[model samples]
Target: MQTQLAVAAYIIHNNKVLLIHHQKLDLWLPVGGHIDQNETPDDALLREIREEVNLEVEILNKLDLPVEGKTKKNLALPFYTNVHSVGDHDHACFYYVCKVINPEKININQKEIKNFDWFTKEELNQKHISENVRNQALEAFKLFEKLTK
Candidate 1:
């Protein structure tokens, strides 16, 4: 199975996580896409968020380790990583928890996303949200709390 590198973000605002109903795949998922050639994961994630929802986000992660030499920059760490099936292909996805920077500016790309909604941790238990997505969303909340506090 071919696996392509991808990035995803669980955007948090007002104690809720945003999820999109993918038009093509017919699944509710976090906003993200494959990393472009020669582009860093951070760049890909930012670009994906911009293109998908037309909003800015702040990745909530504990970047910058004790060892600093030779490192030009410390990229935001993913809260989770996994290889998941995407029909004919698989995506090795890096997942991050992000805080919404511009809450009012959101325009979903209708071509890729059918609809979007912000779900609280309690609301994520609804049957329509997939198990995988629910778990990720919950974990994102934990990571956001741990990192931002």
Candidate 2:
């Protein structure tokens, strides 16, 4: 089976997480998509967010690695990683938590998303949300809270 690399971000603002109802999948999920060729994970993540929600996000997770000799840039590390089946293929997904730079500037791509909303911690526990997404979103919320404090 073919497995493609993908990146996702849980964008948090004002103690709420941004979720998009994907048109094709018909499921509410974090903003993300397949990592394109020649694009780094960080680039793909930012691009996906822009295409999906038109919001710039600041990744909450950071690698403290020293940049001395060769490369001076350090990409944010993923908070979680998993492989999940999608139709006949699979997605090797890297999960990240982020903070929306401008919450009021959102403009969802209507073709890719059915709707978008912000969910609080209590709202994430609703039965309508998929179990996997709920758990991951909760974790992202916790991480974001800890980082900000």
Candidate 3:
């Protein structure tokens, strides 16, 4: 199967995780998309978040490597990674946890997203939410709590 690299961010704010109702797939999912050429996973993730929700976000994952050279820069590591099918193709997705820099400035791109909302951990257990999304979101929330504390 053909596969593409992708990046996704589970943005948390005020103890809630952000989820978008994808128009094309008709499923509730985290904000993310295919990683473009010459773009790192972190770059793709931040760009996708900006394009989808018009909000700047700070990834909670961080690398503690010492700066050893001028050309080297620290990048946040993905919280999770997985391969999933999309039609006949598969995507190798790098998942990350993030926090909105300005939560009040959200403006969803209606062309791509059907709707967006902030969901509490309890809300993720709703019957409408897909099992994969709910589980990942709950994990993101747990990690976010641990990181912030």
- In terms of lDDT, which candidate is stronger, 2 or 3? 2
lDDT of each: 0.93, 0.94, 0.92
Model 3 worst lDDT run, 10 consecutive residues: 63-72
Global lDDT of model 1: 0.93
Q: Which ten residues in a row have the lowest lDDT in candidate 1?
A: 62-71
TM-scores of the candidates are 0.94, 0.96, 0.96
Q: Report lDDT (Cα) of residue 85, candidate 2.
A: 83
> What TM-score would you give candidate 2 relative to the actual structure?
0.96
lDDT of 1 by residue, 14-83 (tens): 8999999999999899999999999999999999999999989988784567656887677898989999
Judging by lDDT against the true structure, name the best candidate.
Answer: 2
lDDT of 3 at 110: 98
Q: What are the per-residue Cα lDDT tens digits for candidate 3 across 60-119?
A: 879777888684777888888999997878999999999789999899999999999899
Assess candidate 3 and give its TM-score to the true structure: 0.96
Task: After superposing candidate 1 on the true structure, give the runs of residues whose Cα lies further than 4 Å from its correct spot.
Answer: 65-69
Flag regions of model 2 displaced more than 4 Å: none
Q: Which pairs clash inside model 3?
A: none
Better structure of 1 and 3 per lDDT:
1
Q: Sorted on lDDT, highest at the top, how do the candidates line up?
A: 2, 1, 3
Q: Assess the local accuracy of residue 66 in candidate 2 as a C-alpha lDDT between 0 and 100.
A: 91
